[model samples]
Target: MFLAQSFVFSLLAITGLALPSNEGVKHNNMARSTKYAPKEPPLTTPWTDKVGTKPWPEYPRPLLQRSDWKNLNGIWKYQNASDLNAVDSPPFGKDLAQEVLIPSCIESGLSGIQTDWGLYSWFSTSFDVSSEWKNDKVLLNFGAVDYEATVFVNGQKAGFHRGGYYRFALDVTEHVKFDQSNELLVFVHDPTDDGDYVIPIGKQTLRPSHIFYTPCSGIWQSVWLEAAPTNYITQLDLDANMDGQVNVTVHSSANGTSAQAKVTVHKDGKTVATHEGPTNKPFQFTVSSPKLWSPDSPNLYNVTVSLDKDEVESYIGFRTISRGVIDGVERPLLNGEFIFMFGTLDQGYWPDGLYTPPNHEAMVYDLKVLKDLGFNMVRKHIKVETDLFYRACDEIGLLVIQDMPSLRPLQSVLPDAKQQAEFARQLDVLVNQFKSYPSIAIWVIYNEGWGQITDTYPEFELTDRVRQLDPTRLVDSTTGWVDHGAGDFSDNHHYANPQCGTPFYSTASSPYDPSRIGFQGEFGGIGNNVSIEHLWNNQAAIDTINQTYEIDTTIEAWNYRSHLLLGELEDQIRLFACSGGVWTQTTDVEGEVNGLITYDRRVSRVDEKQWKADIQALYDAAAARSSNSTRDSL
Candidate 1:
């Protein structure tokens, strides 16, 4: 009965459904803690119950997926210790004091243990190896761990990784006890603003208030295991040219042995191209009558790669993205056609799940809602999300502008040598990890002046490095404040008063150097404190809700403010000639009520139809201006 009701509810959600008022549901004392037995569950999404048995059970890496893999995300024994030296000793035999949900962070509500225990936490679990994986190398893969993570297998150290935002794998072939249960343990340490190191920690604050959010710590993503042959396909690089051909590179490692690879591309369940190449070289093949990928039609071609005894399934889209001058005005072009890039600032935060969503459907829901609202692009602000997010964007045909997570303490000077090196290493890893996704069009190296504050502007060098690494995509050297004469776009930020709407948009100031494209990186932060009557009757939300909203005048003021905000948006896009613009945010984060949707994602403050119309008008106007077409014709 519940499943049937849930299905009905989803169907109703597509058009729009009025939410039940704040009543009936019981509110519990749900304070965040690190204790074994906390008061109660924190705020939960509608998909909470669906996170049963094996949460995030799907293959962690979608671009390179295999059927033979194990999900280790259900339950794991966890122990929190203040002593930093707890990682020296192996935790294979010790009994942990508590059990926490894997993949979700300790600070999140869905993790079972809603806590802020950021550093020196140990987690352990045991799993048996299948008979099919006996002769192959058993590989342990971690989707991501905050800050630093060290792993141990059966009382022996397997490997360690430094970054908190990228995936890393280790080959545990020799250490595994075949066919028997083997103990696995991992220790994580995150200095989330508590330490003196300069690491990239996008928007996380020790004392969170206003724009800063709760610091996520320790195992915030998925962990799993897979079996691969000694001679296997390690990585894939895909590039589709406008000339009806794609360059496919299959990276294989045979442990000093030779291997041959066969690549095949399929469209509409029919084979379109095939090539056989040496394991070390890339193969090029042509697709006859190739269908291009765009927002209107996100056509994807399935790829099958076979290397000796190993086989993997992947997908790619053929599209071209570039910046060009059309009618004397420069704009972002898609498939040799001028396009106006309008997008939202997505922080990738949730009330229940910090880094991870409640379920896969929830991730898709966010993108779907935005797409339905007539958005063609999204600027993933600061943090790097899981592979599922990029995949969802790809399938939904939403262009993505990925930001390199910024460092903490808000420095006005350049980072030290060691920290700079660390940032570069992580940046390289970030590009290599998600570069295969065709949805990702822009790589933002530094945001505002978070870490690169030197007069020499180190961001220029960083942007050059990124361009060299992934020349296929455009690079935005800095988003808001500084531009060191590098990258493809010159960006600016604006927040003008609603009372001065037309004047503000008409005469807005930005650094528009003729050599690069122009972009309004961020603008318009119109606050609308949600009415308590509209929220769920749960104490989980009591802390994040604004007490000032209790006043009736505040509600009226915000409603009028919403009208003014819309006027401001209309004027900005109608008046400005920038290539694109990114609004402040998509959903309301804690303490910031400026999002189009509420933090819970249950309520949209603005009228949905009007909002979509306004956004579409902006796109059409920009397209007309670039193509030198009259607005009436558009």
Candidate 2:
């Protein structure tokens, strides 16, 4: 029987649904330990104080949202595991001697237990199933768990998940008792860079120095509980464009023969479009004169999908990112117009939280500051951030060049079959997971030859797969490496200054592919320590700051170099007709002091007015050159 939405709670009470009982489940009677306290960091953000008992209380997944959910992101019992065999025996119903904060990595200062616990660790907490959710399926959702995680509920092994950068969930309805406290335990194993296996560790390393950073092990994202109907909406694939046509695909857990889907799109609280169809089927609908999304005007429409009794809310922006001939040269186009993608290499890291941000505001603040400084884009350098970070970009109208986290040690030899399969699986996940975000303009496959298979075949294959999976966005096969001559962008990297004539590729001469757009993947390190007091206390980082190409000890010298470098970059776009470029970094990270912003984000190393003006000149130069070309063609 179909129950009305308003009477769902009342009807569930009298439904007489069979609920799990804790008949044989043992209960822990020991008192909770109070040993957990956030370790003091060398640098702290304003949001540090706000991260009290509960951090990241907001819903983790903004793309697919539910109104009723439980945030399990607070204090949790933790203990170090002696060996890998610990997964066989979880300390069920037993009190752990130590505690740590949820979502933060064990190596982070915010996690309380900042000591690295090697390969294995265990986490335990308890949550209650609401009586209103009696007939619903209780989903234990994890935003992300580093490396691998084994989950248990009520002493029963629920499920296991691998891959540190992707989200996963387990249906715990069978093990959870309704209207009662239920024990939930998770065991995590992260080898990081020390393991023999070739995993996508990005920039994490056991020994933190230079570009590699401290490893963020264990659960580094939110843990939550969501109640859903037995037959629910699993996923939504939306393909929106500026021409007012939207292709919608709704995936449901139920059989499509009987299930029905209703989609409604709203603009400014008014219904703009609606469609009714069957589940797991692709359908098309159109909006009247859609407002396109871009860095200048970031417009989004709220969407609601209903599948029988289950409903979810999400939002989408209409935009098209592609390469087109502009001024007789190929250039990146946003909404069919040439726009210079002036950006920064954004390493999404925080001193207090490590892989995770101190809070959502702190994450948004970084992007917001970039936008304020006239940067329209950010290349998320080799790090897959939580959904909140991308959602912030979607709302703030900042373009994102998302890089696939690569394996370590810069592989020159071919990977084994097992390693290749794992890399492909993670790459697939990275592409499919973030494809719905309109702000993501490009997908960067490999960076600077790290973990590259040393052959063009595998690189071409991976790039082809990403293109097939998401044909809407452009793909960058390899950035700053042996330019496999694949994907849409012929990208390259240089330091301290802009290289206009030909990009410096590591393997061979820079291939001038007329089919691909030219992009400066990285340039302009231009280091300046704005404040020594706020600098990272690492002596190696302090001593090595002057070793870079352009290390300015004073503000005046830094600003002068900044203008000169930006002027050269402007010429790269105007004189050489380069499409876009990414500056070295958004903020200084640990031992790498080459950032426009300091490591702690407390001070800006550049002269703000000059920096903003210089960036604006790059766009103006591109516009002027494009205009001249168009006039000449006529």
- Highest TM-score: give the candidate number: 2
User: Ten-residue segment with the worst summed lDDT in candidate 2?
Assistant: 1-10
lDDT of 1 by residue, 1-634 (tens): 1244333433443446753422222222242222232112334456766676478877889888877898888878676755567688554576665667788777775665555546677787898888789899898999999979889999889999998899888999888887798989888888877757688888886677667778788888889889988787778877775556787778876635556788888998899998887776666878887889877788788889899889999988888778776555556777777677778899988777777887889888888888998888999999999998988888999999999998863755446888888898899889988888989989998887788765777787888788777877888888776566778886776663321112223223334665577677877666666666434333433455553222223545654654565555556545654677787678877766677677777877666766777777767766666654422110
TM-score of each: 0.87, 0.92
Runs off by more than 4 Å, candidate 2: 1-34, 255-258, 412-414, 500-511, 530-532, 540-547, 628-634
lDDT of 2 by residue, 306-394 (tens): 98889999888999877778667877778777778989999898887889999888899999999999999999998899998988999
* Clashes by residue pair, model 1: none
Clash pairs detected, candidate 2 = none
